[model samples]
Target: MEEVYGFEMSDGTGDFFGYTADHLFADIWTRPGLTDRDRRLLLIGMLAGQGAADVLGIQVPAAYANGELDDEALREIVIFVCHYAGWPQGARLNSIVEETIAKAARRAARAGESS
Candidate 1:
């Protein structure tokens, strides 16, 4: 984040970024024909092209928490992108997806057991 955006992202700075991110996203990414999940996946694709799988991977949960994604759907998106985006990119994203999925599944499992 500091490398790309030049901001030291503490909670205060991040709050400002969040506000701007929300407005900017509501304008462009949420344009006609795109849902928030679509916008998130699109952003992920673009970021992937720039070799930013770490951020992309981390954003998956945020997207889900923000009501932009579901796990099964994300699985398909990753596989579909793998076909069009090539093996190296696919391999990189695969690690991200696997890690994200495992984290989500673990969280879900823990919640279920506690319930």
Candidate 2:
């Protein structure tokens, strides 16, 4: 959360951070019902449906980073989402996915160079 938002949750949010950490991240996210990949897929769908590009920008890349999604799978998801979420929403998500993939590749190349 700090890396994504640029500040710790305890940096003045009071109990808000505690609730997020204890409930949202620890309790809900750690539940045994769904795999991390399943959670990522569901979140992507929900965010795309609501036109939440800002959060999607973070999440889509995270999906890639966590191995929950690959390029082809992400493309397929965008195409599938187009039918229910409208073309514009799908297009925007497609753009985000492409950008995320490219950024991940750049990061990987840089990491390899430093090795």
Candidate 3:
């Protein structure tokens, strides 16, 4: 979970979280065939197509934080996906991507200042 999402998961025991931890992240995400970057691109496209802005909000930031994507790649994804996903969804995705990059830059600036 930490590697994939750039965050830790709690040991939550319910069916949903358990399945997420034990199956989705542990089994599927860690599988050998696809790199995390490949998965992230596929997932971003799917989510953008479905107009899943909220989840994209989470995923875009995680991709940036995990170094699976960079500013240019993330920006290009918005343009490419928008062509297929439509302008409205592209608008939403663009907002999320830009905000995520800005937030990451701000965080880096803060860390540097602290150092």
Candidate 4:
């Protein structure tokens, strides 16, 4: 699998990223039960419900970049989630999704300019 996303764990983080690499990514993500697209959708919903914005900041863009989701689909998910997860959480996720999409656009524009 391609390494589409990554982050540096801080010095005193006690092997957090290492364990994530060894266990979460290397093991769980490699499991055959779900395709990457399926995993992304599941993760997006779970994170949105739990109001995990920081992780969403990473995942939302990755999902878009990898074609796991699009703006309309994400918008629909946000709307659906609002009824269950509350309006505030949905609103927060909307902002995070908007920011992620905007950043993706900027990156694409820069890549176009250089090409």
Candidate 5:
């Protein structure tokens, strides 16, 4: 497979062209003032709006890496945002939150086994 610019280019995995992804995509993703949990929420909302489900899967689990977010906490965020952002946006976020919650549990379980 040809390494298109920096990404490991593959036809089956994804068809990202690399220019928008490599340069602009990587930079504006993780900004300051946003905790890992906050970043996860923002990304999930944006992904939902744009119908970017693939990236949502990759990011949702990351917030829980530091244990800063939990199932209940994310649920609250979803609830709060729902009141203002409307049900459609909230539903999308809720689904991703559920996915993240599960991911957090799995990671915690693995950590417990190690110790």
Candidate 6:
């Protein structure tokens, strides 16, 4: 969860969190057939197609932070997904992707300056 979301989670919250940690993250995410990057892309496509901007917001930044996606690829995803997912959802995705890219650039700059 922390690896994908970029934040540490508390331990033993409840059944919901437990199932998420033990089953979703531990089992499903770790399956060997697909790489994390591949899963990320598939997840993004599904989220975009479903018009799930809120969740996509989290995944987009995490994907960028984890080096699974770059600015160009993210933008290209917007175009491709928009064609199939509808223009309105694509607009939402485009906004999220651009925002994520800008935030990532700012973060990198701050890290560079701290060095």
Candidate 1 C-alpha lDDT tens digits along 52-112: 7877766665665565667776677678777777767767776777777788789989999
Local distance difference test, each candidate: 0.67, 0.83, 0.92, 0.80, 0.62, 0.91
TM-score of 2: 0.83
Candidate 1 segments exceeding 4 Å error:
1-10, 14-19, 29-33
Positional deviation of 87 in candidate 3, in angstroms? 0.7
TM-score of each: 0.67, 0.83, 0.93, 0.80, 0.53, 0.91
Which of the numbered candidates is closest to the native, going by highest TM-score? 3
Q: Best candidate, lDDT-wise?
A: 3
Model 1 — which ten-residue stretch has the worst lDDT?
1-10
lDDT of 1: 0.67
Residue-level lDDT tens digits of model 6 in 1-115:
8887776676659889999898999999998999888999999999999999999999999999888899999999999998999999999999999999888789889999999
**Cα misplacement distance, residue 84 of candidate 1 (Å):** 2.2
Ranking 1 against 5 by TM-score, winner: 1
1 versus 3: better lDDT goes to: 3
TM-score order, best first, reads 3, 6, 2, 4, 1, 5
Instruction: For candidate 2, write residues 1-115 as lDDT tens digits.
Output: 4333333456646687778776877777778999878888899999999999999888888777777789999999999989989999999999999998889799999999999
> How many collisions per candidate?
0, 0, 0, 0, 0, 0
In candidate 6, stretches whose alpha carbon ends up further than 4 angstroms from where it belongs are 113-115
TM-score of 6: 0.91
TM-score of 5: 0.53
How do the residues 16-72 of candidate 4 rate in per-residue lDDT, one tens digit apiece? 767876788888888998988788878888898899988888888778877878988
Clashes in predicted model 2: 0
Per-residue error for 92 in candidate 2, Å, reads 1.2
